[model samples]
Target: MKISARNRLKGKVVDIVKGATTAHVRIDIGNGVIVTSSITNEAVDELGLKIGADAYAVVKASDVMVAVD
Candidate 1:
């Protein structure tokens, strides 16, 4: 619980897909890493995001575009 965003990714919430108000949270920020976010759905039941629990996928951006072919 801090202010500044530092692209934190400490996760274990392996999946949660809802709609009609957004909710696509997936986190597994380990060796086989994964990080997905689409909050809302009442902030996923007011941050009681179940499914293995333990989460933090904060990726604030100002300018981050890396595309190659």
Candidate 2:
């Protein structure tokens, strides 16, 4: 798929938690690091996300904020 987002991480679905309207999907990108994304339940189902399923974490944002304490 061609997307405008350049930051794409390929990983496998590790866990999933579904809520009323949203769902938390976790993907392991290797080195024991996992990325979690909160998306709509319809999206989760439409993508057929499940444990051991291969997927990509597409990050598309205009700006990112970082704070150091």
Candidate 3:
């Protein structure tokens, strides 16, 4: 699917921290970089997101910013 988030980071799942109802997902964006985000447990479970899996990081337009310097 096409997303509007400009900072699209494709990475491998490195860690999955579980919460009461949500999951703190950590992905390895290569070059020794990692990104973390919160997602519903159901969503992650439904998508079967696990360590070593490939996934994309999507951020909404309202959640992103591009500053002109």
Candidate 4:
């Protein structure tokens, strides 16, 4: 599928935590680095995401903020 996002990291689905309306999907890119994304449960089912499934973490954000105290 064609996408507008450029930051696409290929990885494998490691874990999935479902909530009432949202779900956390974790993907292991490499070297013990994992990225978690919170999306709707319906999206999870539509994508057929499951453990050991290969997928891409499509990162398309305008700004990423980091704060430390």
lDDT of 3 by residue, 21-58 (tens): 98999989899989888999898999899899998777
Q: Tell me which residue pairs clash in candidate 2.
A: none
The regions of model 1 sitting more than 4 angstroms off are 1-4, 10-13, 31-56, 59-69
Better-scoring candidate (lDDT), 1 or 2: 2
Q: What TM-score does candidate 4 get on C-alpha atoms?
A: 0.86
Residue 16 C-alpha lDDT in model 3 = 92
The 10 consecutive residues of candidate 2 with the worst lDDT sum are: 58-67
Query: Between prediction 1 and prediction 4, which has the larger TM-score?
Result: 4
Report the lDDT tens digits of candidate 2 across residue range 1-69.
698986789999999999999999999999988999999999999988889999998887653456899
Whose TM-score is greatest here?
A: 2
Q: In lDDT terms, how accurate is model 3?
A: 0.87
lDDT values of the candidates? Answer: 0.86, 0.90, 0.87, 0.92
Which residue pairs show collisions in model 4?
none
Q: TM per model?
A: 0.31, 0.87, 0.81, 0.86
Better of 3 and 4 by TM-score: 4
lDDT of 1 by residue, 1-69 (tens): 584765777878999999999999999989998888998889999888999989888876653457899
